[model samples]
Target chain A: MNRTFRNMLLTLCTISLMAGLSWADTLKVGVQAPITGSYANEGQGIENGVRLLASQINAAGGVLGKQIEVIPCDDQGTAMAAAICAKDLVNKGVSMVIGSYTSTCAQAAQKTYFNAGVIQTSDGTADSLTENGYWTFLRNSFPNSAEGEFAANYMVNVKKYKRIVVLSDFSTYADGLGNATEAAIKKLGGNVVSRDKIKADSQNFTPVLTNVKSKNPDVIFFAGYYSDGGQLRAQQMALGIKADFIGGDANDNPDFIKLAGSAAEGAFIINVPSPDVLPYPIAKSFIADYQKTYGEMPPSIWGLMNIDGMRAIIHAMEQNKSFDTKKAVDYLHNLQTPIDGITGPIAFAKDGNRKGGAYVVKKIQADGTYFNEYVQ
Target chain B: MDIFLQQLANGLTIGSMFALVALGYTMVYGVMKLINFAHGDMVAASAFVGLTIYTQIMGQAASLAAVIVIFLLTAAVMACIGIILERVAYRPLREAPRLSAVVSALGASLVIQNGIMLIWGPRMKIFPELVPQVYWDFGGVVISLIQVIILALSLFLMVSLYLFVEKTRMGAAIRASSIDQDAARLMGINVNSIIMIIFIIGSSLGAVGGLFIGLYYRGITFNMGWQYGLYAFIAAIIGGIGNIPGAMLGGMLLGLFNAFIAGYISSTWADAFTFILLILILIVRPTGLLGERVAEKV
Candidate 1:
């Protein structure tokens, strides 16, 4: 009776092991984002978008004849937390990572993903993110330099602002954009009256605004996140500074309107075409499905851009019929035809930066809706 | 000259809030020789509680009467929390080593900060406009109505606290306990009750600071306590850790330093310059500007 029981247990164990092996055949995609922190709205949007796209792909047919498994890690919008998330995700055996709303978090986790041979696609726009020449790193969004050039041309040529004051928080992305814009303005012979830095989330920009007002600036360009951007606009108005307020790409968030309140009106935000404004059918359908699923629009263009990055990576994998990182990177770098992305045609430069820049300057109307003023 | 005046006005507005928060640190340290690291988080939590009361209970009412009512209710709730925190986190460890209590305080700080983050969902909440946007421009120096009210309210609270601590019988008990807990206890004073009272006053004052910040800045986050708390802590130390009036002076001085430094020098160097000045002050006056030098008891 004992021998018979042992044989029966062995047989059951073997069958369960086989079932586990079949279940484990699925591909793992990691999402590293600030799912909970000051930038929680943006992080949550990215997570939601990635999940929505993954589900749609799975519904049609699993990737490579296997289901796509999503493993999400919340970086808390901090560099330290992002480093830990990167390690955690890599240890989970993910082949690719779609993540990190902020440039600081993305840059923090960049090396870890590279060392582990995992492909990482981020919406972080810092120019330095691609400067390291990390093959594993791909930027879904255009670099700060691209936006800077566009902003400089518009401010100098189109608007013809005489005294422009540049403001930024002490974050990697904001500082980079601020410097880039400042340099671009100087290059175009535009007078940058003052360059100032504000402590992010300090909740008070009056001191800085007052100082800027003293300079008699014609326009004030703030290169910072929406959290600070919105407050800056509100305080700028409170201080009765009549200068035109322009916000960088990071200011393209719904909360900017809510936080700035009525001050959001007449403020201008420069960013890549917002998700809702994308003319691509793929973008529209994806947005509709996302809205149907999440019951709200994606927080900003960053979420959709991240989704497009994921789509492009998966498409490259499908083209090559391989899950290898090296093969996918090569395919993405030298595409015969650019994959149709929600934001635009998805292509990458040699240094992993996104090819082409299509930024739009949108004016915040009185009703808290964006009016596309100019597209470049 | 206009910029200087405007910067000064801005300095005073921020300094008042810092002074209010510094009072909490000073009071708690005065009575119990322990630095309540969690005091800042308490302020943040109170602001959130105030937000809830304003939105849910008050139905987003913007009347001055409703604002005052909300402030009182929020203070009361924070006082209760303060009492509970003292009992659970500090009371048992009171007999332990000083470092142990400090560690416990740090732990409490983390617990409260994370607890708030978990509860509030870690997003920056926009504080609705409690006061109408009205600016008073004095020859290029703009001062808003809310700024005036904040200055008035902060000054009123600080003066009231000063009077209470100086004149009231319970205030006498608190001062006595701070001077010598054992002696005060022997003198028929309930030291435990005195400590509880100190927590109540400190927490309530910090709560008001939180509300003031929320109303003024219009942005409240879960971890904002760390930054604001650090500034207030520095203020308390600069004024002399256990000195109430010193905290006030320190806060105002710090605020002025920040504004002037940012206006005249560089905004990025304001914090760095402040720290250097703090070091200079400590080297010159070990007990702070107003801190009385008391010989250590053997």
Candidate 2:
């Protein structure tokens, strides 16, 4: 054959192979959460956020000119169910996943995503989850790293707390908050006069209150969910122990106000910076669109992550010009866009966490509503 | 020393709450030879009732009459639930294999919690604190007022129950029924009524436990009953399966064991310690603190 013909044939062969290997034809992402179990109500909000974002992206000519398909996987809010969902999503060739809202579920699926070489971002903040890797997982921008300094900084520096009593459920998730806040308290030259660990599901914290009372701490720092935090506050006030009950992101739930009733007033939390509370211009439009479609405000914790994740994925696909895993990931690492992302035009850190991150302070209002008080 | 005593005093109050709930398990199992696995949900149900009443009675100051009325209402309403559950669930399967009844009880429990969720909603509602957490200290041992009352109330119930069982005619009938249902039936005692009564009493006790649980803990939920219920059931079994006094002893032992273990060792091992203690007791005593020696028949 002539040299020119030989080179042309070789070029044609390479181009054909490249065309065949391009994964743009099937742009696939998986969104996972519990459609059942304890967190189902909250999970619905998360699913809605991501789904709506994906829909918006698809409406905008789809990712890389191919239709973006988001596969919904049910974690059932349990570890085992989440692992099963992870395995299925991996098998379906999903290059990216947003999933498994609770820490326990996230833990179960982390290994699966890690092994499958799929990137995942979860709404859960258990201390151990994203500690190991940058490739395998990302949290909703906020990691447990914030809870330590955030809680203490708010109470000690912002709220000017001095004598504090720390209450913890000692759960896999809240333990981080507890350890963090306690250390922060000590670091600020303030002391933890009392510390008590309760069963995670404990309804009564009165006995602990007595121990707390002896310490006479001005603030009662509780690291757990709304149910326990609010209940502890209500019970303490009913007894008139009068310590300002403080907590982490768990307190940023309306359920705390409902549970604490009149006692919920002035209770403080270090929390996720809300889509509603963000000073960024995108929050207003996002909230309006969310309320218009879903008939409610965006959910407190898990919702924004999924929305931001979908935006990230779609943006990555657009930048890569293909939906192939390697290209999409590389795009994710490099692509930057001013998306009106729910958690404030989120930028990822080198470790793929949200840049300019996490809420430092929130307050529970009189009517059982939570509002962000400070964001940096 | 002060902190140590104070924590013990604090834990004792929690132990008292455990005892109050454990009584229902012990009493129900003592006569019926059934686990009454639903006893925990029964606690949830009664708490719901109190919570509903608390909502109604909000903005009002605490009164002795109001307290008595609420307690009586809780007992009566829960007694009815207990009786109905027993009639529909237990009596039909009295002659059948025991496992079926236990399974049915579990179903009933699941149904009850779900029913509450349906009737109410999935969101956990906080019941108003029934006990005012007034603190009273003796030297260094600080006792919350709720703890004092739970200790007093549980003791009052226990002493009265012991006296009634040991000294009253109906109590004799109950004891007779517990010992031998067939014998009690042959002696013209309505064994069915006795069983119904047992259910009512056990559930009423659970109802009070539930009410006190609200005042003591201040948070009530659809599933709050299970944690305490599991511990109560374990206490019942470890204290010789169906012995009343044994259940009480077992609860105290378990509580003390947990507190000491958490204090002495890693707090994480407290659960393991309690379970290990149960297994050890099961091996050594088989029956427990007040449990009767049952001769294994060859």
Candidate 3:
């Protein structure tokens, strides 16, 4: 009996050794997202998109002749958790990371990835994300400055509304977007009556709305995530506020309509083309493939954008014919040809911010569908 | 003037909910002298439970009968949970150090909060509108039908609780146990039963508050308890930790203070102003406005 037990132990040791050896031949990609917190839906969508892409690449003979292994770390949509996840992923020896849907999380993990010389890409649109000259970090989505300009133009030129009220929560992303939009509005000689800040998840905005109501603004622009955005819209409608409600990029989620109920109708949301509205054939096919694998469509355009980031990084690596992050980073910085992405032609500027942002002003229809009212 | 009236109406609507939640804290602290830190999470859990029951019973059209049934069923289920929490977390530490029970209460709060998050999947659930959206404009101060219903129901509950605690034979026993547990036991009153009764009343009131919030706010999340619970805790303290009427007054004052601060000043400073007010009150009154200076029993 003792001899048999010893033999079993020896077999387990050999199996584990073989497993460890095979891991060395695989390309490890880390995903840092808010997998289980207030932003769980977006975080889970990013994880699903990256994992699906990894499996597809593996099935097609992998990247750099190595099987792709995806490692996911849940940042829970907080800066502290994102920093911890950055350390964890770095310790796990990941060559690249595609993740962290929110800008604050991405910014928190930015320095860590830069120090470790790991290529990191995310859908966070906060303007400060790429401002620090982090060679290791690339923004998958357009910065808030771009969207802010588009929103200002739409409000000033297209819709021609006066007395705009810019509202935002205390998050780094929302507050920055609010500032950008407010500044852009002023630049265009548009009248911004009030710039208000709200405590996120307070579930009570009546006081602020009451104050805004007195201003008699024609437009109320809320730059916050869908969680608070929907509530703000619903409450605004309930209070009989006559202003036209326009939500910023972060408010473009199905849950927003769900939370807003019937009040969602006639509300406008400004963002890049939604996942279903993308005109690219590759976008359509990848979305179809994602739906087939995950049994649900991608949560929003953010997830597909992150997947595009992953595809861009892999394309750069294939062009350089190497897994060295430094070479891939250099290739990505000055790509002679833009890579076709699920969003659009993916290209990065010298500052690591995505180049050429296209935005649309989509109004919510009675049936809870978004109608593209104007495009820029 | 119209804006002032509207702000006042908003303050009262929010204060009604705070007052309801504050009662649970005051009642539990009154009996055991142990603050049930789990009270806020209990309110959140009850709201989720209420949501489930509400969805099941609510048809294409909502009825007054169905709404009452939802409230009662949620309260009953939450009362059972409160009893279980007391048994598992507090009862064991009853004879232990007071700080141990407080720590245990905090632990229970975490467990319930995380459990709700796991069950509900961290997404905010929208509460179905049970009443028709009818707004009554009072010379620019618009009041929704739902807001009126909330105020009326909360007032009813608070009055019922006050009467039950002041006028009934069980009320006397409860007061006795709270004042001196050993004396009450020697007087042939079952102190354990009184404690159990306190949990039931406190949990039920909190459950109703949960329902009211879900109906009023229309958006509920797993960790929502911490925010509302903290406000309600402050409300309880401001009113006097062991007094019922104190909670009601405290909640209203805090609500008014918050509304005025957010309106006249800035929303960013409202929370900071609330904390400052709390600190000032603590320094000035110490025992709270309604709290009496009771000598420690030898």
Candidate 4:
């Protein structure tokens, strides 16, 4: 009786092993990020999100009833490395690509993906990306230009600042953000005392900070990634400069708190609305299901968008009921299905932009990051 | 005026970092006939070791004493690594062709840097700010307490180093090795040990550089050493390769040059100016300010 039971267990194990091997040949989604360099913290979320989403999709009977495989590439968070990932992905035969943690990197990869006729979804929303118009290229993340306008409006209209200062990294994204924000501030009857671009890796902005302090600007809008943002925040507060730090999405990370410590307590930053998953049952269910399967809520906005990007592609494939690239693009262009996504009310506009219902204001709080409901 | 003073202070603070890192480069080149390309990354590795102690085993409340203990432990470990690199990777090729030795050092550098990334991770973490930044003014110039301390410490270290090399027997033997390796070896000196000693001392200097970088920047990415390392190398070259005082001059000059460019020249041209200065200097003085053309013996 014991020998017979052991033989039966061995037979069951072989069958499961066979199933695992076949799982290797499932649908592949290539994910890219700056996993090898200075921007790795930011990149970590973007890469992990692709896998998190892929697992979710695969669990739902897979895409086209086939399991999903997430293939990730490291771009080291640099532009040049991102381009290489694009080329490498195309050769690897991934149908669509999700990538690029920074605008600089997205800019480089967009060209490569477009030329290769491969599809791409990016989190970095540099304005120059709009000109490409690759039907295959789509950015779910709002551009920094929009962020700039929103930040400026909030400072002048809500805070009622008389004079504002602008400090931007010389990145294409930050510069566009700074320029648009500067215009917004002036339109609101606010004067710009100082506008300067600091080096991306600059350790100190005391020169710029001091000048602004001397001018006594009511508020300062800093446009840069979290690395520089945190340092500037710490130094500004440490030196007794009282200007409020207003920045865009790059400041949306826990690392900012780690760098600035107590100095970051009252700092303000602008970001698109993450669906208030707590209050809304639909969004809460999505988060619950995600955590049950993957063990954590999507850490950053990129996780939800990446999952949404995969769903968009999979939804398109189901509509056409095939793996054709053009068919997928057509489905994305005319996405009409009221898919209940984790981010709420998923639908695309004519120009491939997420509908206005999306973009919400989030505030960093002591307990957890909070988002204000959009009152449109 | 407040902004100008602040920027000036910022420049000096960063200059202090360059000075510390520059010492490692200057000293190694001064004592050995080779540049330890791995010095900067060794600093990075030590910081990671320090960080591992803080966030992992020790927990958040790791005391000031614990932090210092970890730092010294890391420094000692890094010293051993530096000595080993000199012994195994470098000493074998010391008598070989110059190009081969330089290439070997470069290869060692790449290995050490990438090895750290593989072992730890590539993600940037917020390093604990070990010291607080406060301010004082001298002659109407704003200076942060941290910056003043950094400057003062660097000056003290450099002076002590100068005195040791001028007065001590080991320092004299190290100097003699650089001047004439064969002569020192024949003079009943352990030439290899002196070279190892130079590396250990230089690596400790790099550890100091790394600690300062962690505190001042308050964030450390895996690749933090590359750009800073390159800049220090440029400072070393500009000061006159293998010259101690020259490295100091180069670091100060580079810092002042960058601050002036950002302040006076268009801020957009700040990055372009550094390269332009390097190119112009290269054209004018290929061997740098105080470098001498040494004849080779076949």
Candidate 5:
């Protein structure tokens, strides 16, 4: 061949390679999390779980023959930031999104993602989240109402606590759970002696605990994050309030045990089946792999749920052979078989909240670790 | 009555932490006449230093000696940080416009908070429980060993601070410099060294408060500086801005008020009530409870 012809051939080859590099048909999944603020731990934990699952899916020959790319958008754990993150992700043309540790953030992002016709799933469990009539939004976590009802029944039926004090951090999520729990307890003929709302960053729980002590409640139900819950437990012990402290999903973190220390003993937390307790080989191996990869157990069950939620989304995409938002939404909403999640079997209701998601009432044992008392 | 007693005890416990942190704010304001916004971040930084020493360096064998060692190490290290912060972030801006110095303090606050976030990865850490679990029961009102220690230590430090400010030569220099920097310098007082000494004392006190909070709550987040810092600033303002005794008084009063409101009214309204009180106080007496209206008071 002539020198000019040879050079042209080389240029053509380079063009093809560049085309393959630039337009490789990768599926982009946006991960929205508060990765730079006080709630960064929870958001980071969720991102880790999703990233790990994405790697696993890619290793298994990718989803729908396309390489999975998980892009994280830090929302700083604020509703405003979350909305901006949602808009940015939609602008980036991501196929799907996993997000938002708090319900308020999820709700904030819902309008943006819904308007853009992008699929988004959250671990936040606020009941009204699914009621927003957004086809694009789904929650893999169970509702706050469910968890609250479960907790109330446990307190009234199992422990037979007649007088209870319900306390929340006054966030939408915490207040919803606290209200539901109080209503449930009252419905079951249990007296809600007092109800109080505390600030999310409250350092002192003495006044609230003192008031509860005066009420002589048999149990104190706290609906808030581990920071508040753990400190509340410690302060309650300090103030000689012997009432057992029970809390919602936010209590399902290692930080709670660490902060509460000896006070965490006998405290009950409503949680999903942690990966360690999942009887499935898939879950057991996931836990083992997580430990090997991350050097610790998953921080909370929400981490495992994020993995399963992403898995379900990917499975739906594979079944439909399309990244079209409407198709994926329909597939997820009509998921006939439950996805075998690391936590447990996860199915979705028509409203997009997780259906048949098993909750477990776990007690913090004397060994400073949680043990599943019973599955609900 | 039992509830009132319990709330009071709780208020005092939290009040001691506020007073300790308020001393840092007031002292810096007294000497430099500049609000050190980074004062609260120093608490967080010191707590993390103490936490690192206790958990990573000292390991599981931490005892009373370990606690004391960690406390001293944190205080010393944070004092050094205060010196460096003053030298790098504040001293150059010292001769600049007063607003520039204030802006620099705010910038320093952001840098410290975000720097901590970068180092610690924005995760909340559980401080090692150094104080043993023991409670003194008074019928329905109980107090823990940690609370007692916090109260006693704060009282000792406040008393020492009072005596040092009133009696010591360094304290005299600090007071003189606060009155007139040029006059103090002309009087053979090394104003720069006195300023550094003030930073040292303030930073150490802030560290002690931070360490106590970490032990009491057993949780520390990087941004905790802002929360505690805001409260300390409020207390300082309420007690009469740069007045040391006023800061102590403001801290106790604020704590008691917070506890009472939360106990009697609503915990959700506690913070709102606090701000309302601040607004009311400002409206009623802009000079604060102990602040002087005349310029010669400084």
Candidate 6:
């Protein structure tokens, strides 16, 4: 009797194991972000956005009726760590990966994702990221060069500034935008009075500002992160230079106005349209839900981009009726209609760069508030 | 000529800050013969302490009285921290091999830096604008009122420090201890207290430098100490590491060189060129410009 009972238990266990193998109904998505280190705030913001998207998707019966699982891997804001994260996620058999705010980390993971045949939707904005012809790599954010051109055009054509001086931190992102803006300004028949580069950790800009004052430019275009941008704005005012300060997405943070204080007033910033500017019900609902869950407004409008990226992949999976990376890549590449993004309608160009991504021109108000001045 | 004057003002302003921080390095090395690598980190800590006092405690009021209070409180807190660090980290290793003490100093620097990072997080904070900004334009050469105050304050502090080191009984005790620790102890001098006082004085000067940096830059970061510390160390070495006045001179000269290079050449080359000039100076005069020629007493 004991032998018969043991054999029956073994038979039941074998059948359950076979069922588990055949009926796997979970999709693993990898989240690569610098969840710690210098860019931890940005990484946390991106991670929160991705998690919000996943929860919303899961609550509404999920994609293809399979539960979505997020495998978080902190890239620590470095390329080497990003590459390792991509490899680790690939080894975990994740269908796709989303991540990485900085271009350096995204570019580092490019070949790894490409070789592993995983679709990587990154927010990195370097133009060279897409120029490499990686079929699996698609960027959700607009290129820095595009932002640079937009800034130059806005200053010269719209604001009607003729004499422009450029300052950059010489990081890949800053230099790219600075050089591109300089080129575009000259292309549009505007004068570039002087160009200067500041080191990353420099706190004092008096000598540089003094030199800039000597040139007497009408508009000073700064292309660095908000920390230095704010410092420069304050120093410019302190030195009595009357040039208008303008910068790229790096200066979009609220901290810019606080640091620059009264000096930040009238300064223009070009970045992706913030969530506050999004008028669509979809965007509104996402914001409300995100705030309800996370206890804050989305860290930045880039949170919307991350949501749209996740939606694009989930929508593709739903269309394909299976979790296939190849089909998702194909769907993103040969898209006939635009995917509704909180930022705007998201569609990929031939190079897998998002086509409908728009730059919003924002001006800092006198009372340290931002108002949308223009959108393109 | 206007540009030269403007650069000169810039050099003097920056030089004063460097000199203030270099004094700390010079004093500690003078007494202990140990490079307190953590000296720079102390400056950074003082900045954060001053920031916390302004924002959290003082409710972000931009008054001169608040600034004075914060400066004094920050200096006092930093002095206590310096004393504790010396007692715990340096004093135990006083008799150990100098390499062990050096390693301990590096470890102490990491602890302080990371400890501050953990408390404040890694965001760059804008220092409160207590002093109203006013520029003083002399024809084409523009200088800020803050620049004048910074220069005056730095010179006053350096002079006061020089007097304290040269004139008082405690000053004589400190000088005696630095010259011959065992002999000073045998002659009834409280060698430990003298060293403690040295740390206190050095750290207080560092606190002042940190406060000025926050005011001048209007922004401070957790890792700012590393850059400022490196520059101050170079300044101390260039002025003769153990010589107090040498440190002040070294800092001012380094600041002048930096400003001139940035004004005339490229800002990118300012740091590289400064180091290159230092190497050249060292090659020419191994004992530095004001370094004394003291024979081995042993």
State the lDDT of candidate 2 residue by residue for A1-376, as single tens digits: 6999999999999987765654446567787787654455566777787777777767877766666677888786667788899999887778888876677777888888888878888867775776676565766656665777777777788778678877777656677767777887788877778667876554545445655666777888888766567777765775456667777775666667766766678877777665666776666777788899999886575677766776776666666666555565556556466446767665665565655665656677776566666775
TM-score of each: 0.95, 0.81, 0.95, 0.89, 0.95, 0.90
Per-residue alpha-carbon lDDT of candidate 4 for residues B3-69, written as tens digits (9 for 90 to 100): 5666666666667677677878888887666777877788777677667766775675545576566
List model 6 lDDT by residue over A144-259, tens digit each: 87887888889889989878899988666678788888898889898899989987558777778889988988988998877678888888887778888887787777667877
Q: Compared with the real two-chain complex, what DockQ does model 6 have?
A: 0.40
In model 6 chain B, the worst 10-residue window by lDDT is B122-131
> Residue B76: error of model 2 in Å?
3.3
Give the C-alpha lDDT of model 3: 0.90
Give fnat of each prediction, in order: 0.64, 0.17, 0.64, 0.60, 0.81, 0.50
Best by lDDT: 1
**Residue pairs clashing, model 3:** none
Candidate ordering by DockQ (highest first): 5, 3, 1, 4, 6, 2
**C-alpha RMSD values across all candidates:** 3.4, 8.5, 2.9, 6.5, 4.5, 5.1
TM-score winner between 1 and 4, please give it.
1
- Tens digit per residue, CA lDDT, model 1, A1-376: 9999999999999988976774578788999998887898999999999899889989989888878889999998889999999999988889999988999999999999999999999999999999998999989999999999999999999999999999999899999999999999999999999999998877767778888998999899999999999989998999899999999999999989988887889999999888887889999999999999989988899998899899999999998999999899999999877899999999998899999878889999999999999988
Of models 1 and 5, which has the larger TM-score? 1
* Top model number, DockQ: 5
Candidate 1 docking band: medium
Model 5 lDDT per residue over B170-265, tens place = 889988998889999999999899989999999999999999989998888898999999999999999988889989988888889999999999
- Candidate lDDT scores, in order, read 0.91, 0.73, 0.90, 0.73, 0.86, 0.85
Interface RMSD of each: 1.2, 4.4, 1.3, 2.5, 1.1, 2.3
Mind giving the per-residue lDDT tens digits that candidate 5 earns over A298-356? 87877777777788888888889887779977988887788777767777778888887
Q: Model 4, range A252-291, lDDT digits (tens) per residue?
A: 6677777786577777767665433435565577667666
Question: Model 3, range A1-376, lDDT digits (tens) per residue?
Answer: 9999999999999988976875678899999999876687798899999999999999999987999889999998899999999999998889999988999999999999999999999999889998899999988999999999999999988889989999999887999999999999999999999999998878889999998999999999999999888889988988889999999999998889987887889999999999998999999999999999989889899999999999999999988899999889888889878999999999888888888888999999999999999988
Error of 4 at A168 (Å): 1.9
Docking class of 2: incorrect
